[model samples]
Structures are given as structure tokens and as C-alpha cells.
Target: MVSLTPVDIEGFTFLAISVELPKTTLLVVTSERGYIMCGALDVGLLNERLKDRKILAGRAVGVKTIDELLEAPLESVTHEALDAGITPGMLGKDALLLML
Candidate 1:
């Protein structure tokens, strides 16, 4: 099951997702403004993948989903970033702004 709730952390607003599974709990956090930060388990892996892609794209930050992002071989995840028009620097700034 999945549950969504609004939460305030350090003054910033976020939407939290609680996923109940057999073994572990999964939490996904998205900024109320639409930025996704860190999360649990596979979510962290997804964040790392996106972060790596952002760096390769020459920008600071970006927003993406595993299903929506482009898959590139031989090149970094930059293809998705380029398609999304996000810069690595912008990713960083936005992440900071969202307090992620």
C-alpha cells in the first residue's frame, strides 16, 4: 500500500510517500515545489543515478523518473538531462533550495 502525506522539514514543505512492504518500509520524498530528493532503498539508487546523469549533462541538477529517463549506452545519463534541458548546476541549486 502507498500513503501520501504533507510534511514540513526545516521549514520546507514536502510530499511524503509511505510504502508498506513485507520486509522494509519505503519512503519517497518530493518537494512541494516538485523536486525529488533522497529516499529509501531503490529510491536512493534512483537519486544516485539521476545525480550522475545531471553531472554528465554539465548541469548541477535535474528531475527525472526511472521510467521516463532515457537510457544511453557508452555515454552517461546526460541524454536525459539534455532532453530535459537541465543543467548540473541547476540541479544542485534546486536541490539546495528544496533543502534536499
Candidate 2:
């Protein structure tokens, strides 16, 4: 199951989605500014690593998860996010701009 809500932040309105799957849940907030995501962050390391540095390129954030998520280390990021000065240890919420 997935639920979507409208979010207002930094004068921009974006869509936040919560996805429930058999093994995990995913949380995502997306806008023209960027995309923030976590929980079951990634599936495979090698494939993800390459794609992370390429397509995602600082526009995405990934984090590991167990049960509910609070604060966790970033597992991967896109180049655009890196350009935004984001890195592996930044808090998920902090990495996301205009988060509510």
C-alpha cells in the first residue's frame, strides 16, 4: 500500500509518499529541488553503487532501515546530492531540504 500527501516547504509544494511492501516500507519526498528517500534504501550494492554515482547523482538519498526509522547513516547518494554538500553521515532529515 502507498499513501501520498501534499507537502509545503521552502515555498515549494511537493509530494510525499509512504510505501508498504511485504518486507519493508519506503518513505519518499520529491520535488524539483531534489528527492529524499529511505527505508530499504537499496537492494544490491554493486549495481546500486554504479547507478548511484550516475543517474541519481545528488538527487537522491538512501539509508538502511529496520522497523521504524529515526536517524540513520546514509548508505548512498547521487552526484547532485553530493553537489548539495550531502554525504554518507548526514541525517536523513537534514539531507532533505524543506522537510516537515
lDDT for each residue of candidate 2 in 12-89, tens digit (9 for 90 to 100): 566767788887667776665655666344524423556554333122334333211224555666665666776766
Off by over 4 Å in 2: 7-14, 43-71, 98-100
Residue-level lDDT of model 1, residues 54-90, one tens digit each, is 3322211122321111111111214434445443334
Model 1 CA lDDT for position 73: 19
Q: TM-score winner among the candidates?
A: 2
User: What lDDT score is found at residue 45 in candidate 1?
Assistant: 39
- TM-score per candidate: 0.37, 0.55
- For candidate 1, the 10 contiguous residues with the lowest summed lDDT are 66-75
What is the lDDT, from 0 to 100, of the residue 14 in candidate 1? 59
Cand. 1 Cα-lDDT: 0.38
